[model samples]
Target chain A: MLNIKNLKVSVENKLILNDLNLKINPGEVHAIMGPNGSGKSTLANVLSGKKGYEIQGEILFDELNINDISVEERAQKGIFLAFQYPVEIPGVNTNVFLRTSLNSIRKSKGEKELDTLTFLKLIKEKAKELGIDEKFLSRQLNVGFSGGEKKKNEILQMKLLQPKLSILDETDSGLDIDALKIVADGVNSYKKKDNAFLIITHYQRLLDYIKPDFIHVLSKGKIVKTGSAELALELEKSGYKNL
Target chain B: MKNQNLNINQEYKYGFTTDIESIKAPKGLSEESIKFISNIKKEPSWMLDWRLKAFKRLKTLKEPNWQKPKYPKIDYQDLYYYSAPKSSSNKPKSLDEIDPKIIETYKKLGIPLVEQQRLNGIAVDAVFDSVSVATTFKEELTKKGIIFCSISEAIQKHPELVKKYIGSVIPLSDHYFATLNSAVFTDGSFVYIPPNTRCPMELSTYFRINASETGQFERTLIIADKGSYVSYLEGCTAPMRDENQLHAANVELIALDDAEIKYSTVQNWYPGDKDGVGGIYNFVTKRGICKGKNSKISWTQVETGSAITWKYPSCILQGDNSVGEFYSIAITNNHQKADTGTKMIHLGKNTKSKIISKGISAGFADNTYRGLVDINEKATNSRNYTQCDSLLMGNKCGAHTVPYIKNKNSTSTIEHEATTTKINEEQLYYCNQRGLDQEEAVSLIVNGFCKEVLQQLPMEFAVEAQKLVAISLEGSVG
Candidate 1:
């Protein structure tokens, strides 16, 4: 339930994404694979409503144009972007941040907010499923976390927020094999008929875990090729040069 | 997205001036003004003489200019030194007799001046302008042998304690502002805890400056007797004025043998406007001494307001095995200027001290941390640890750290650490992407940075201080 038409993005007058178009329906998974300098990450950033970018064209979620929405509003409207590198916010406890984020979205959606005890109970169950220590939630947010832990934490947030449209921007880059499987399992279990995912990556390894319904190759800021799950394995063998 | 509305009234919520008739002393800083103050308070001859002595020294003490901020010379002859609400001419013997308007003013400020509406366990002394209008839970405090009263009342009733402890820590000729405060100081809180006793409740003083062109000079004294313990809190606010106002206060604390004194301050004076045209010039002197063996003293402050803030809450470790600690969080935004820190002096053997300071600068403000640690020759085996951290929101603001450490004994050890960091844009974006606005994100990150210092405050004050930290940084982000 997401649509992008002729989306052109630039920063500091340098074009990053050029004439990009994509669409994802409910219950579907789409993968965009590209080589270095291809606009895969740019597409993710543009969709999340980041500032300081010169953007053109339109992006629609559920037939509602969201190009003019703020970042927080976009998040409240069920748009989630998993960053390539999570930030280390010292002094902010992970649990508190999670609660604040959850309650803010809940308030915007006119839903009942969870109290501390209720939130703790829900978070504990989710953390256990993802193999996260309870102690990490009490510490500073991602201050000294390892690479794998950060990716796991990202997935935990994804599961917690339960956003309708999840954009995974290089989520599998720093994860080990076990961690990658845990992330894939977390996403696979949450995949519902009303939710969609846009997976952006460089390798075919992650696709082996969570198969995509369709795959598109992005080259020099445009989509150059489209195929099914087989395209990822083919590109991994032949590389983008022969695409 | 909905249009974000910026409410200007919420910026300085305490900027409303109370409209009331006031009786003011003749404008000027002279022997006559000091005498007028002493006469109105009806002080004893000895107390008047003490004030006169401080006035004599103030004449020769030129205002110090070593601070980072430089302001226009204050015209002492053109400013009123004392202004009190006319309704307080005859002190109220009961809460019912107090002026209704004065009580209403305190009510609007969220202070419970009446006994029926008291804040559960904390005893408050509400000082309006130059006079203390009401002190809550006085009789209850007296039941536990805790002497909590206005300094004016202390001079008349408990002269012995006042005469002995007054100027004992800071002295009359300490410096420019302290000396001036000693000379014409009209009213503040005084507290005393008897030996072998822990105070039953927190003692707090709320100072409000409601008169225009009148300098607020308050003197606070607190003493913890042998083996006794006490905690005191002080808060200040003023109306938004177009002309700069002066607030020079002196606070002294003494801890006797095995005694401990914890003092905390939440200074939220008016910081002028965004253009920095007017605000309070808060120059204060606060010092505590660990006088007897094994005594301890600690200072905690959250400074968020004032056009220019210049204060150093210090401690002198004079007893063997005594300890001293300073925890401070100073925030300057929207053209505000602050130069604050603490000093720890070790004079006894095995004395120890620790300091933690966090300074946040936003808009075009400037924040500085100036601290000193001195270990005397006799203080063998003494140790000191210090940490200073600064956070800046934008490139237009500035933060500075200046630390001076001196150790005369070879056996003493001193450790110091300092860091300066700009607010991480990525962190803000992360929080924003998770559903928080820019302001909320900034507040979350800032509160985390000041967590160490905010923890030192009492539970009730800690919550308020956290909110104040957020409000101080409102509209700071671009």
Candidate 2:
């Protein structure tokens, strides 16, 4: 349900994503493995419609061009990007943000809004499943949250939003093994036949739990190779130098 | 949730006047006018003498020019010194006896003085025009040996207390407004909590200016004796008029050893029409003194209305281990101009102070957050943290921050931070993408902007203030 055709993007007049191309269909998980400067996170940001980007190519979501949509509109269109570095908003509680985002998406879909009690129940259940402490819901979003906790919060938002397309940008970074498993499990539990994911990572470890239907090697903002899940193992055995 | 069902044709809900005609001096400020006011109030000879001295100072004291927005020089002589609606033929013995129009005005304002006493368990000293109309729950407070009444009544009942503490912190010559207020001030609330006595209820003063040309100059003094505690609330509103009204008032608080005083003000004076033609020029001077050791004082204000507002409720922390705090949320909409903040002076050892101010400027309005925190040499180990945040709604409006910090003690720690930002487009887009309108998104973001200060208000006032913030920003977005 996502397509990119020779997408060339630049930020602040500096070319970040050169001629990049990728595609993913529903019910499929795609992983993009790249070195530090391969423009992996930049690609994720451009897809989420973050401001200050110069794009020369087309990006399509469900057959609609989405390069001009706002961040929130992208969210309503069922496109979620878990940030590598979460933004900290003091005095804005996590639960409030999640509920607001969920209700916002629901409203855009012409769905009924959930009352406070119902929203609380849903959040409580999802938070527990994600092993998120109840107190974290009342604290300001990402304020003073540890690295792992912020990543887990991103997953929690994804589960509650239940977006059709999820883009994870190095969600496993800074997380311990246990936190990595919890975060992966949260993403795994939200997987559905009608939804898709574009997971970006530097290591092959996350692929152990979240198996990818297709693997693409990205270098210098271009996809150099495309293969099956086994291609992740090959990359792990030999670094990008051998590619 | 009392909704104000306003009649479409009503000039303004609080615009109604009492039939009890007031004895007013001719509009103008002269030595004669000052003397007329003091004589009309039947002040003590010494007080009249004090008024004369203040009149002299008023002449020499130039009108402050540093505040935002410029206006014609105040035609002191052209403004009525005192104006009150004629009193009821028979003074209202209770809430029911008061004028129905007056009661309705309070109801529309959500103060429901009588209902608040019966349902919400709050005591209200409702001041209409220049006179104290009714003070509810006085008997219960008197039983606790607390003196809560009009300043006029206090002078007669508790002369010693009023005589000793009035103008102790804010002298008559402290500022031009203070001098003006000192000379013509007619009536305001006076509270004296005796030593070791905790006030039984939250004392509130609601000042409403009803007369057309009458300028409201009321003075409030609250004294919390040793080991005593009291929380006082001040609120004001005026009738909408084409001619701008002047409201210059003085408030003084004194906290003795181990005493604590909490003062809150929600000033919603008629802010004129959207074009800012005629609204109350609210220039007030309010300060508190921590006299004895361990005394604490806090000033919390939500200033949402006024054509031009220049007020700074401050505190002087004198005694050892004393504390002072100022929390405020000032919103300026349309053509309103507000330059308000606070001053905290720490004089004793281990004293602490905090100032949190939020200014929201919308339309063509200008809002400024100005504050000062000074730590004296004797105030070792003193600490202060000040955070001032301003939000601009449109490009036409302005938000400015001016903070002055003076620390003389080596052991003191003072941190001041300020940030000015326009409402985030991303945040708004995010909210709208979810289906909420732009106004709702702006309200949510603005509410979050002032959340730190709003949380400091009493629960009931917090909700009201939050709603006011949204309403004030209603037409701000394009």
Candidate 2 residue-wise lDDT, B1-478, digit = tens: 1112212121323444444455567667777777766665566777777778888888889888887667778877778877654553233567777777777777776775774445665678878777777788888898999988888777767778877988788897888889888888878999989999988767888999887788888989999999999988878877778889889889999999999999988888888887788998998899999999999999999998889999889989999999999999999988899999999999989999999999989889999888889999989999999999988887999998888889999999999988998887656644543334556567777877787888877676787777777776775775
TM-score of 2: 0.83
Model 2 docking category: incorrect
Local distance difference test, each candidate: 0.92, 0.83
Which of the CAPRI classes, incorrect, acceptable, medium or high, describes model 1?
medium
Question: Across residues A32-121, which tens digit of lDDT does each residue of candidate 2 receive?
Answer: 998999899888888887667899989999999887776666777888888787766566667777776788778878899888799999
Model 2 residue B183 lDDT score: 80
Q: What is the interface RMSD of each candidate, in Å?
A: 1.7, 8.7
Best by TM-score: 1
lDDT of candidate model 2 versus the reference: 0.83
Clashes of 1: 0
